[model samples]
Target: MTAGDELSDATAEYITANDIEHVQIVGGTGAVSADVASALTTLGVDTVARVEGDSAAAVSVALAGLANDGCGDDLGLVSSDRVALVRGNPDGVVAAAVLASSLAGGYLVTPLVVGDTLPAWVRGCLAATPRNIGADRLNLGVVAVGGTAAVSEATMEAAPDAASSTDALTVRIGAATDTSRDGAINADDPVRPDTATAGTATAISATASPATGPVLSLCFSDAVTATDNVDRVRDVVEVNGIAAVVVNAAGNAGSVCDQSRIDVTLGQTLSAGDVISVDGSSIKLGTSADQRSFGSATATVTAPARDRVRPTISIVGIAGAATARSTFEIAFGDNVALAGTALLANDEVRIVGGPGGTSPAPAVSVAHEPGASAAVATVSRPLRPGDRLIVDPGAVEDGSGNQSAGTSGSAIRAQASPRINQVLMSDLKHTAHATWTVPTGSVAGVGGTGAGITIRAKGDGDAAGAAGNGWSMVFDRASTYSADKPLDIGVSVDPKGKRVTVRFNNGPATATLGDLIAALNGDDKFAALFSAGSPAALWRLPTMRPVLCWAWSRLATWLRASATPVAPSSPSR
Candidate 1:
């Protein structure tokens, strides 16, 4: 059945009534482990156990043992060789044991330490006291019916013939000090004085002892003597009883005789009371007279030598005829020095060419010489284009200065002069005519019809005005008849009229018109003028038979005021 299927009624009732915790089954058996566990758990069992083994029979044997034990614990079978008890349910325990025994040959019973807690099913089987078989020595064999009995009866036994023992050896100390003593007296004797008198006889006594526990006494005194009475003595006794000598002295020369000569140096110069020790002992004394001397020595001194001074001069910008006469100044830096010797006059001075010259050339002149400030004394000379002045400080001085020429020099070209010219508009010439034409239906004089005017610029030359040269123009207004109509004319100039003019009928117009036109033409202006708008209302015929009509009577008056031409005689009629 699928894992979802419920347990059979008989199995479920048996598990519940018996209080079985879990059921264990071999995986290869007809009953699947998970299915059996689920079935038992559904009836109130909560755990299951699996056993590990090599064969199913070993596993079955282990399960059978658990079943006969009367335990109600969940049991589980793991690897074909081993079984585990999961809970304390009778069915689970029995099933686990039976399964383990069935897989006996494949099963391996793991050895556990004594007192280790076991699962419920295993514990129940052990509590039943199962019979034991001779499978205990087999490293991985299952105990099936006797697993618990065999484990409970096992014990750890020690091997036979084992023992331990101990032993000791003797140790001794060796002598560390010499037993042989030289014929010497110990200073520790009460009759011996620790301090010796200077320049007098005194005694030294010492106690000698063996370093090993017991010490022997040698009471003898050695005469203490000093060069001066104030000497003091210091002595060290060796382990072999030999005494070393040292000495010191007080201010008085006769105080300690024993130590008086302890520090004495024979034949060598010393203060009268200097301490002198006997060949083998220590003693010291103050000086009988003060007589010690020392001398002082002297040290040497040194100074740095002075450096030789050299002077140099540099010059620039010597060029052209004018520049040839030009004096090129030379500068001397503080680092330069001048010799007292005067530079010969007329000594050649080097001149370097400037940008004005085609190539950099070194030119020499006989006019200049070195001056006192380490500079060359130069006289103005005419220079050529591209000529530059440069000074070289040679071994010998030039009369120009005490200076010598520098290794390098520089120059720049003279700035070119600027040329300027002014031209006037009057100088400009107009090659073509400046003409204006009346519009269609318009007359050249007087007011015309409402036709516009046209202006044409044929050509122009010398736009810049020159002296006595200017532009001229002619304007014509024609008369015509039109009712209630006035003629208007407008003019303008481009580029804000810097050079433009206006005139009427070939004559100068009034200031009013001129001003208005000027304002209109002033830097982009436009202006217009209109004739009187009043129109003539009357019309009349001419006295002559040819029949000429006058639009206004003023026309006759206007014609009379004008100059008329005389008529010539007609040919034979």
Candidate 2:
């Protein structure tokens, strides 16, 4: 008999007085309350049974057995190993059962959702027959049962050796969505199959741990219609005339946006809304001033989905050129993904209208700067004043798969600088000399007349190469000097290569100056060298160094004084 309330002593007594032969409980949790079970026993009604869950519903459909077991077309009558449900109102539950049974294949496996509005969908399904759903609509249904490791009776052993009666059953349920599910299923909800299993018994669960509720199941009739609702299907088991419902709790709930989600990688620890940039295959946070950013997301994600956006380019400044080497920077609109093959060369940049009748286009190398939404490109050739650069289409791409378009820019004038290619040393006619090759090219000296150059020789220790008097020598031709020209340094110009060579002569010494020569050649401090190119480039000799030139002068003096040794070793006599 169907009853909404619990059966008590009064109900039992009434049943006994009527001389009822047996009792069968249907619906309403699928099991009679313990009080009612005891009451019926006291009245001597031994034949008591319950049909709940899918089994109760299946009884009505299977009453007329099919000529063939697999011939039934309805989700209710079809043979399925498992069924998932979305619990709702009475009508919704009934409709869910009918829908599951009607659509269930040999095995109906689908994630279903039930909520206040699911009943209407069910009604629609009932109104329409012979309509087939796409395979994508229904998930393969699975029945998972879990609870405290403890069984209600000692008759059954625990499934695991370590299982204790106190152990709680926590089966991890996986969801199809990436977001976490929370507050969907409530406590003590029933979980059940939509139809009976092969054995004519429906699997069901009735107790949901109040602490951890079940994740809300998803139900959808079409792509446009879907819901994640608070509905539960009990995990039911009928054995020994006892209809048992296993408890299931834990429902996941969240609103899924139409856009996709992504993981984010940041240069620094992430904060909410921090900008993202591409650095090869990975992503990192961009600077606040960096306007170029793919998008923003929670710091937790290593990479997140964003609109496919292109990067914008801006010129920071131009450098190099005077020395035949140039460098420039291009700022991006935002930080981007630059991993894999994402970051590539901007082949569109070309140089035009530069001096020397050569392509002003700089041979450049590209690199992404960390924490900045900019890229640095270094050029191999010098830039002329009139040179202009044109960036054709497809110059660069951002991490988010955005490519830069064509643009144009003018090269700014830069000062010229002298570069020392290599140094040369020699001993010609007993005169130790050093020569420095400075290529000035089109770079003029200060005031545009000529490159002003200076060469000073200190005695390694003193201010000049000489010990007693002319310790330092100024090689500038413009400087005044005695006719003797005691200083042995000279500066000359090479007009052909547009080069300057400085010569330092230790003076004609008949005696060996090997030690001093070695010092002069080895010690960069042997001389102080300086130069000012037209525009002005700062450079120094790599091997030039400070040394004990004063000591060398002393040694030279001693060498000259001993040159007249009367009779060397006239005798250890």
Candidate 3:
């Protein structure tokens, strides 16, 4: 009722017909004036009282023949958990009252709507209501009457923790989604605020509560019909961008009038920060005014993410072979993000490396899509068989803005590179001899396999190397030997003459053979091919025959064979 208004005739008649015993006017003068309650006194049937939101106001009015010492401390509502979390929305309260209260007593409790700010009436009731000292503690057992959304855990935790007396009103909150308790019912409406007229472009301004039975209110430039109205309303009205089935609709004025408002009672309750929208352009209003709809409009969603749990990450998979820029696929258990100042400032999504020899060396960067649980990270260096992914702490967050813990992912696989193996040099067709250089492990990294060595052999007439495939040393018998004549031929290498000189030998034949061997062995270039003491079988017959001849040649010349040829006389053959 307004400041000077009285109860309507219909409401008065309903009150009388219902055989109601008590009338408790809720709210202060600002809401319904005292004059509205006076009508109840005139009926002369039962008690009339007023309960103001000012929970602890002192009044000194005298009343005779009435025992009014004070209300005792028997907080007699059978909620095993001391706290009776009633619905904060009016529609929900009405539903709860109808189910829990007797017709004789009037139920008038202001709804709790705001997220962080508790209603004054709620505070007063909590402070004044006596708590049950069960479960070995004196704390409030917060039981969500409907769904957890009925009263969010975050919201209820913000309430006052102390009563006016010595007892501390610490709260023990349970799951808000818990529905096993008594009086749990799924309300059939979503958040329905006051009407938003299309012509007026009136911005919606009302808070909704109760996890079940949410309400959302909207107005068309022209009135809509009741036939198939719910279906029509659902076609245009949406919650979070999806069409929602409307359970009820009425005009704002009166139920009897066709213009009576159609309040939205969603089958589910409204969560904090939910956006409700209406496609006014698609609506068909039944009126004489303009049929133009109220374009697209958001119902309202005005709170930040208040999720209570933190997010965590795990590696789902790696893309192909790991390389310097390998993609490490990761996942968090909830919707995650890496945007905004908080996320960016802390490098919310980054890959890290440790002291171990890891593939794709550290200092990795992370990327994520909005409202997704998955992400990809880029590594800095070539990946090794031992490479594993690690995420930095506070690198990502969930929808509730909870940061993730430092996490490690599964190991990445390194590509197996091709290797070289050789066989032994043997005439047999199936010999198993071999030789090689590189092994097969982690060779093809981000830079890929490197260029290997190339080799080619010179043919018989090819330019080959200098000195025409190198120098040569050939030996031969310069002169023939005889038995009677002393050895006349001795071996010597003539560097410039290019010949093996043979003549009479005055010293031991072995000395000459030693000289040839010494000269050949002295040169480092020839040592590899013909070492002084190599196996004789490995050498050619021509080379070895000359050395044998020189080794045992008689110490005589060809002319002085018989009787030592007197005075250099020629010997007869």
Candidate 4:
């Protein structure tokens, strides 16, 4: 029942030391089991049997055969299972090993008809230190199990309901002396409540071993059952003739060993098959204990290393362009060095948005700012209103070599005044009597005025060539309409109190074109236009091209000569 090597060696030593004559090894098929058999025979001791099995049932059959023979007291049964046994006998002994293979099969069923002798053999291994002392030298607590009054000194007490028929029960015991070790309970150890109590039959199917006290829990074979008009209950179960209440209505059946197999207070990790000995009332592993340890103990496993956090980029400050160049200040969440020799070449720092107002934005230059925490990016072009600049992160790494976070850049923008563009002039066609042009000062909508041009016709009191010189009308900024008829132009004062105009026409001798142009300019109407070559005559020059132009119909052309109108105003949407 003990471990492989220790079982064989200890038994042999005890036999030789005590001058034993006869021996029997039962129920084992391991190398150590065979060695025990061989060593006994070599020592001139008679070997009775060597039991072997492929399963628990087969082993039970083998044990039954040997128990029937009833040959020796010092018997040996060997197996690789966790069972351990060490019994002392002055005359003879029977030792056996229930190896690892058959131990899991649970119960070792014996001859049903046989009495105590067969069941005792079925009890199999008992924990102890093998010695040549008399059987009385080591006292074992009195224990018993099922069937009519099988346990000695059991008393029956009143239960709510006692079965009309005979009931079965299981029982257990502990050391009589406080100094003695508590008896070890094995799995399938037969137990029954006191027969004298009124209750149903019950059995114990668990192993219970306490670490250091006389305390032991005895469980019932089944739940408390009711019979007749009452509930059956066992009151007290006597061990060694002392009445005690050890019966539990609810049974806890399973392996009941200390959570820690061997006490670890001595700094020794316990394993199965370790040779154990009792030294001064304490049990411990032997020097030659088998090194082939048992089950795996519960423990925790941890990782060795962890990774660092990645760095991130953020915008420190953004300022409007004071000069032609726009600048942005940027910083990183972590201290980082440029990836390459220069900031622009560093793949880590990417200029996500090009220069603010530069048409084909050029590459931006970066300079480390006064504070080591941030840097400045200078764009080559002047920033325009509503311009956005972006900088993204790439291969930048922190001091610990952790790469910067790959994400969108912190954006920045510069400011400027609002402006508008002039409408294109080629969109219009000319008529036979007059030509039109859009002036440079005009803007879209109500923002800018039509200016910088004058309109004059040849029929404007020029007696020398009155009939041949047709009226030449020069347009200012009035390019926002599409029509076959003449576009309307009126006068209005701007926020700055300046008069703006969009229309002009030929005039008669009493009010010549030169005189009309001078009058409009004096009123802060359209841009001033007087011929430098001849102040007396208002003329169009080749250099004075229109900014935006549109043609008027022939019918509308005659109306301008009769009207002495105010300055022209910007067209409506």
Q: Whose lDDT is greatest here?
A: 3
Q: Sort by TM-score, best first.
A: 3, 2, 4, 1
lDDT per residue, candidate 1, 1-573, as tens digits? 223244667766777788876565443334454566556665677776654343333344454554434332333333322333222223344544454444544332322222123433334333333111121111111232234432232221110001010001111111111111111111111111112222211322221111112111211111122332322222321221233221222121221211211221111122222222222223221223211111111111111123243454444443433334455545443232344464433434555555554344544543333445444434334445555554444644433343444444443334465222212222133222222222222222222343222222212212211211222222223243321222123333332322232322121111122112222223233221111111111011111111112233644454333211011111111
Regions more than 4 Å wrong, model 2: 1-310, 320-325, 334-340, 353-362, 368-373, 382-386, 398-402, 413-573
Candidate with top TM-score is 3
Determine which window of 10 residues in candidate 2 has minimal summed lDDT.
564-573
Better candidate by TM-score, 1 or 3: 3
Model 1 residue 466 distance off true place after TM-score fit, in angstroms = 65
Badly placed stretches (over 4 Å) of model 3 are 1-306, 317-325, 335-361, 369-372, 412-573
TM-score preference between candidates 3 and 4, better one = 3
* Model 4 lDDT tens row, 1-573: 345644456666777788877665545665246665666678667544666665433454455455434531333332221222222111012222222224424322222111223222323322111111121111122112233332122211211011111122222221112111111221112222111323222421122222221122222221111221011112232223333222222222111111111111111222222221211111111112211111111111112133375655554323354554455555655422333322222233434443454455445666763325456666555434444445544434555566655543333333375333212221111111122322312212111233323232212222112121222223332334332222223333232432234343322212222223333334432322111011111232122233222333532453343333222222111
lDDT (Cα atoms) of all candidates against the true structure: 0.29, 0.31, 0.38, 0.30
Q: Model 3 misses residue 442 by how many Å?
A: 67
427-539: candidate 2 lDDT, tens digit per residue:
11111111222111111110112222212221222322112122222122223423232223344443233223334342222211121222233334342321111111113
TM-scores of the candidates are: 0.16, 0.20, 0.23, 0.17
